[model samples]
Target: MASLLAAVVSAVVLALSSMLSERHCAFGFGGFQCNDPVAGYGSVLLTATLASFAILIVSALIATWKLVAWFRAR
Candidate 1:
């Protein structure tokens, strides 16, 4: 339950960050909107979300495998 909840929260956080960053990009200006914080943030959020999910899945898999091994050994 807790793990599921964490995943849900992670997804939400990433989505929100992406959204806010997108807004910043749309409004911020430079020659080519080069001064935008939104575009950068959106990229960052995408990267972070990808990394976070990979880490979560790897850790969860390892933990579950360990648990099964532990119980089997007992």
Candidate 2:
């Protein structure tokens, strides 16, 4: 259950990041502008998405371990 929740949350974050990226930074002219709000926002989202993925991975590992233990006990 925890893993499932994590997976769903991670998927949502990924979708949001993709949507934001698609909506911004499309023009063929750029060179690392520090004052770009879109870039800053994107960076924050990227960090969040990465952290969510890490949580998802850990949850998955826990779920798998529990399942294996249950099967072994049965």
Candidate 3:
């Protein structure tokens, strides 16, 4: 259940970042490169990327823990 929730949240985060990139740059987020960004664009993008990573890491950790627990129970 936790893993599923994490997956959903991570998807949402990525979508939001993509939308933000579209708004700020002519190129999309997948390009991963933006030239002549407005003031503070870099910082905002960095923060969003970091947050997405953090959520994914946590989700992985949770899933791993659950799997280990299940194995031990068996």
Q: TM-score of each candidate?
A: 0.49, 0.58, 0.52
Query: Per-model C-alpha lDDT, please?
Result: 0.57, 0.65, 0.71
Model 3: clashing residue pairs? none
Candidate 1 Cα RMSD (Å): 6.0
How do the residues 1-74 of candidate 1 rate in per-residue lDDT, one tens digit apiece? 45555556665766765565455643334322313544445446556657766656765666677778879999
lDDT tens readout by residue for model 2, 1-74: 77767777877777776566566634345532223457656556556657776876787787788889889999
Clashing pairs in 1: 21-38
**Candidate 3 lDDT, 1-74, residue by residue in tens:** 77968867886886787676666655456544555655347556756867887887888788888989999999
Poorly placed runs, candidate 1 (over 4 Å): 1-39
Worst 10 residues of 2 by lDDT: 26-35
Instruction: Find the number of clashing residue pairs for candidate 3.
Output: 0
